[model samples]
Target chain A: MSPADRFARLPDLLAADSDLQRRGRWVTVDCRVDVGDQPFFLALENGALAAFERGTRLMRSSAFTVGATDEAWTQHWQPVPAPGWHDLFALTKRGVASMEGDFRPLLQNLQFFKDLLALPRRLPERI
Target chain B: MAPVLDPMIGRYLRLQIDGVDHRVYFEEAGRGIPLVCLHTAGADGRQYRHLLADPAVTSRFRVLAFDMPWHGKSTPPDGWEKSEYRLTTASYTAAIRAFCKAMELDKPVVMGCSIGGRIVLNLAIAHAAEFRALIALEAADFQQPWYDTAWLHRPDVHGGEACAALVSGLIAPQSPPVSRHETLWMYMQGGPGVFKGDLYFYRVDGDLREKVKSIDTKVCPLYLLTGEYDFSCTSEDTLRTAAQIPGVEVQIMKHVGHFPMSEHPAKFREYILPILEKIS
Candidate 1:
């Protein structure tokens, strides 16, 4: 399957996973996750991933943007990524990823977002 | 009876720290040289549960783990609500000294993790003669804060859950499911704003690069063990800090991360048992 097609499945996959739903119970925000240069905008409402947009919309704004290189994302989803690649913050701390925009919703629902971004790991292989 | 009682004993003592009365909670077991264990930031003495329970360690050393004021079962000093909780270098070392004096621990070996790891260097610097040895885990001389700590205690966030989640990534995936979750539970139970308060010391007040050379390893030996997966204070950080102190021993543990004792007690035991033997 194409990478975009795989990302398109994020909403349904996230909604179906009860554990992810519980973790995101308090989160409601639209955030953009960039895998390398590919942008995937995700809308999280209350506890569910409301929408998944594969491409950037004109004049579209997000609550936050969390991104890493294709290399970093690939490493992070390796069932067990190496020491510096295991976590989003880990990637950020190591200078391989970036998180910017309004800090409130992003930091408040950090775990939810972390789990959300790593959802691809549950897939059979790296997307 | 199927019910199993732990070999460790728990008790509380009222001690004066910085002229404030603090009811500190502590647990201990075994007998020999006094081995005082210090927990990580925002965590209590309970992190050392496995160490305190192990017969191999206890038989040769009196393992004592104490919860600092404002952590674990320990109570904050009177009028704590009016002021912010920021741990400074002086206050941290002073508390350890006072605890040691009150307990009459004669030159005890002090072993600590995370924030506990940072302070042991100061303990060695300011008062090396007061200890038999110092074991530092997941430690470095200095670590810049990687994220805004304010997120840890914001009104909009569930402080406990946020704190636990933020730290969850620091534990290695190689750790057992039970040990990993148990380690995070400590953070989940931390008091509001306490984790941020601890970072005040970890990130701001505890920069030890300039002062570490003052640590005299001759008077009290210094041992550092960092897990391979702890990006916060990566193994490189431990090695760099160890290089600063002549005769300081350093080892990088494989298949473990931060919160070694809590996240993988059995694995942590493999690394620490050898050190305990060397100290013996």
Candidate 2:
């Protein structure tokens, strides 16, 4: 499946998972994730994914953007990534990923994003 | 380049501390009074790579940096994989004591940053006469809350990455790009669960508020330095802690952060030289 399709599935997966829903509750933030060339925006409110959209033009309300190479994203979405590709911070630290704009929200809800991003790794191969 | 001095050497020593054998990895350079440097939590001796290379430091003092067990090149003892490795004050001090004894370092001037910084207080309090002095960077009574560790223990949450982000946030906003990236890279390479295990000591087991009053500066002079942007242990935190310990000297490192030695070695060295001069 294309990265966009996989990203689009995140909202539903987040909603269905009770743990993420509860943990993300009261966390409202607009974030952008750039996988390879494909850029996606996620609007999260009250612990639920409010919106998931594709493209680079960010919502004026977006707080931060997390971008990584396609290869890095591919490795990250694997069931078990190698040393450098396992975490978003790891990618940023290794220069494989970049995070821009306001970082407060990103750090304030680090685990939420950490769990949210790992969702795609659990999807079936056909998805 | 100027004339090349002696090159740094990397070696391992087998030592039994607290009844467990550990293969400790360490780097050494120069010859003179021993200056033992300790790296931050989850990081190894490589943080002092530049310090080891600096002739100003090496010419006067024999500098050595060792990787704590389960960190950097140091291997964990038997059965470590099955159980979580937590760094309590007792375990940390024991390793340092054993390391010093094995190296035959007579009252070495020990310096450490972050968890390395926090443990030096314990070293001074328990074994004051063992070291000539103590230099602590980003040392505090306790670290403030930054990231939640519950997710770090989860299977989906990669500890190394989570730790990198947590540490990156504490770095000074004005740190140079190359230095910042280099410092971050160190966190990325940490062993699994090492960061979290070390925090247990930094945050919980290493609380020195009640214990700091017992430190005798005359026996082992305590020097505290905190970076301007280190939110984990702010300058204010170090100052407040320093106020309690009589004769303890404190300084605020401008435009630096948690990892002073690694983040900006040249800048950090400038601050350190004055201190070393006073001691020498």
- Highest TM-score: give the candidate number: 1
What lDDT tens digits, residue by residue, belong to model 1 across residues B1-280?
Answer: 6879999999998888888788999999999999999999898998999999999999999999999889999988989999889998889898988898889998899999999999998898888998999999988999756788878887888888888888888999899999998888999899999989998999988999979988888899999999998988998889989888998999999989999999999999999999999998
**Model 2 ranges with Cα > 4 A deviation:** A1-127, B1-6
Q: Encode model 2's per-residue lDDT on A22-103: one tens digit a residue.
A: 9778579888888888888888888787788877673355789888887777777776554445556656655778888886
TM-score of chain B of 1: 0.98
Reference-based lDDT, each prediction: 0.88, 0.82
RMSD of each: 1.6, 12.4
lDDT of 2 at B215: 90
Q: Give one digit per residue, the lDDT tens place, for model 2 in B1-280.
A: 8987547999998998898999999999988889999999888899899899988988899999999999998999989979998899999999988999999998899999988888888887888888999998889877565445554554655666666666775665556778877887888788888777888887778888888888999998999999876767777889988988999999999877788888888889989999988887
Listed per prediction, chain B TM-scores read 0.98, 0.96
